[model samples]
Target: MKEFLTDPHQIERESMRIIQGHLQLDWTEQELKIVERCIHTSGDPSLEPVIRIHSQAIEAGLEALKRGALVITDVEMVRAGIAKKQLAQLGSTVECFLSDFQVAAQAAEWGITRSMAALRMNKERLKGAIVAIGNAPTALLEVLELAKDPQTRPALIVGIPVGFVGAKESKDLLWEEHQELPSITILGNRGGSPLAATCVNALIYLAVKREI
Candidate 1:
């Protein structure tokens, strides 16, 4: 990683080479050089490397906040309560809320997309419906309603757990609360998290790009 960071140009060249070699795609020497150069000048080492967020980090962040310390948490921490706990521990009068609203919003958007596709039977004709459960019962209901129609049903149902809160309620909502729609042929909960929703959104983007 350090070597790649220091010589990003080399990294890019190596990456392109690997990609081209594996895919049997031809690339001009000049194009490869250009890509390498672009990689090198992209940024400086002092800039922080991206990190995946996790629950432990959130706990740490919460602990920090409790200490009345100025807290800086990564995206993963935002969803976790570490920063909040830290603040509470310190007795600091400061009130702060860490949120990965971007991620949440993205999930919501994907839910909307899924709902739309399910409603229109778009997935049946195009890709296929794969329903994934989320943390929010209300949100799940919304998605289900959107997907419901006379002719189309979801091909798959994924029950992905979202974070620590609302898991049971969300599950109940998906399983027991809502009326089963005829359009949904498959139903299975993945028991993961909202992370699955994020992944689904990313998959959509990839699919679109691949088409383009």
Candidate 2:
């Protein structure tokens, strides 16, 4: 852990090369990078079948990201995992609403989890941005609800929060309630901060790999 911790890029690349030769993930070359990165992040091969994406989500996400849209996350860890060097070159950055002081105040007032309140507070910013929720199902649920407004809709939603309670239900609701929103989702409780962050980083990596 110490060796890789100091240089994640080297570890990630080396691991992916080894893993790629052994198991074939079912995705386009572009999409495969994201899956491979997620697996690399979690060290979980079982996630190959669980990570789900709409046919057009990647392309749409790529287009939005290429246009230099903001990447909004539910937590700070998700924001931190983004490749800042690559994103800086593209003139984009990651943001998380959860840490804002107003979110806590609003959460208390509204009787909602801070994640949900943070998302609600950032509705304007969420518009046309990439929404990545890693730690909270309430965040995804709020995003799905916000998407009912055409203006509040995100460019792409990464909905793979980890938990048994409301996690599966939140993703299912995103699928059932708002079919119009473009999204990447892990179709079960088997997801986490690393997996969610890797998806965002993967998109950024794909967009900037050749040039970076």
lDDT of each: 0.33, 0.83
Q: Which candidate achieves the best lDDT against the true structure?
A: 2
Q: Which ranges of candidate 1 are over 4 A from the true structure?
A: 1-128, 134-138, 178-190, 194-212
Clashing pairs for model 2 are none
What TM-score do all the candidates reach, one by one?
A: 0.26, 0.90
Looking at candidate 1, the ten consecutive residues that score lowest on lDDT are: 44-53
Worst 10 residues of 2 by lDDT: 1-10
Candidate 2: RMSD to truth? 3.0
lDDT of 1 by residue, 1-212 (tens): 35334575666556645444433223344222322222232222211121112213223333333344332111232224222332344543221121423444544667643323232332232122334333433334544554565333433333334345555455555556444521111122222333333322222223223221
For model 2, state the Cα shift of residue 148 in Å: 1.0
Prediction 2 TM-score vs. true? 0.90
Backbone clash tally (model 2): 0
Which RMSD does model 1 reach against the true structure?
18.7
